[model samples]
Target: MAESDAWILTTGLNNGVSKLVGEGISQYRLLRRHPKDVVCIGLTMWGTINEKTRIDLKKASQIGASDEACKRQIRDDVQEDKETLDPHHTHCILFDSGNLNEYLSDSQRSSFVQYVCDDKNSHACKEVFFDNMNFQQRLIEL
Candidate 1:
């Protein structure tokens, strides 16, 4: 595939697979000396527990409040955390969801998949699907 037509989209920055993908992309860029050829995007659920925890800690420290009080304030504040794009990623997209890694609703899943598959720049394609049982097998085969 042409480098400019490539994109690496991940579930989140905090996962093992996502980290590996980031490292792979970084290595690719280094070897090719093409820093902007591909896009690395991290897609994370809004208000996920991990995200909330980080925001809570920051808010608590900033306002000098107890944890319980901070939690209350966070509820009232209701603003989403500022984007902290992973070092390896070039961009990020956040979606609204109740919790972490919850099955995305049909519409949301469709939209996300469409974004990946029909990206304007992509022409030819390659995909690897992995699951708990077959992930190792698939990787070995690849």
Candidate 2:
């Protein structure tokens, strides 16, 4: 299947909004791998609401704030950016993860995690994971 066709497959995932973000980065890189894809997938797992949830997204170069701040920033930025950019041109996908069940299934999240781990998309995940490892390790310490 073509890139566009594969994008359609992600459209049905629980992480659809995030997959779109990652795919946009993939397209931006002209089919080359990008660090954003894995970050986007990881962000999707953090849940969309609750300001604390978005802290993980701060690792993405495209996002400028911690997870909590990112939730509010993304909403405002997307709305403002949308005024000047076409919907399709807006590279970031900003839906609430609190509503993830409305969009993706448990299996879909597993698929996303796998995709991020897959060698083909490991760059994104590695970047995201490194940034979050300190935090994750602290959690383990607890």
Candidate 3:
């Protein structure tokens, strides 16, 4: 329960606050407020990703089928479910595992990759994760 330690969970993050609570920890305060006995996700802001990939390869009459349509249908279903459940959680969305690559340009991506690479063995990723907190604290300086 060190101030710098957290119990992290790996989920799609699309499930939103309910899933966060259902999995354990009633709130996102684990990221702060009450840092002890925290519950956190390694990848956040992934609601869009969860909506994009799913598999429901079952034919109308057949039990098993391998078709693009089936996969798309399943993906859509997953998206619907995730969309319905997302929201209600207020927390900084920590990006990891190339999740934010789409928003970054090639140069920015390279810079971030290098930054993270510099801390590959340490928990330096958390600094970026909580960068907003730093920004907020500096609002007066602006």
Q: Which candidate leads in TM-score? A: 1
Best prediction by lDDT: 1
Q: Candidate 3 has which clashing residue pairs, if any?
A: none
Worst 10 residues of 1 by lDDT: 133-142
Comparison by lDDT, 1 against 2, better one: 1
Q: Which tens-of-lDDT digit does each residue in 1-142 have in candidate 1? A: 2343455556545546776777777787888754556666766655443455545545746776556545542454566543333568776566766554443243663476566556667555534222112332111111
TM-score of 1: 0.49
* TM-score of every prediction relative to native: 0.49, 0.21, 0.26
Cα lDDT tens digits, model 3, 12-131, are 244544355434544434456644544443333332343343232135335555565345534233425332223332332433344422321334323543554466465432422221
How would the candidate models be sorted by lDDT, starting from the highest?
A: 1, 3, 2
Ranking by TM-score: 1, 3, 2
Predicted candidate 2 versus true structure: per-residue lDDT over 1-142, tens digit per residue: 1222122122312233534544565566575554232222222222333332334445554556555454553443343211111123223333455543243344654454455455452333122221212332111110
Per-candidate Cα lDDT values, in order, are: 0.53, 0.34, 0.36
Runs in model 3 deviating more than 4 A are: 1-4, 12-23, 27-39, 42-81, 84-117, 120-142
Task: List where candidate 2 sits over 4 angstroms from the true fold.
Answer: 2-53, 66-92, 97-142
- Candidate 3 has its poorest 10 consecutive residues by lDDT at 133-142
The positional error of residue 125 in candidate 2, measured at the CA in angstroms, is: 31
123 Cα displacement, candidate 3 (Å): 7.3
For candidate 2, give the lDDT. Answer: 0.34
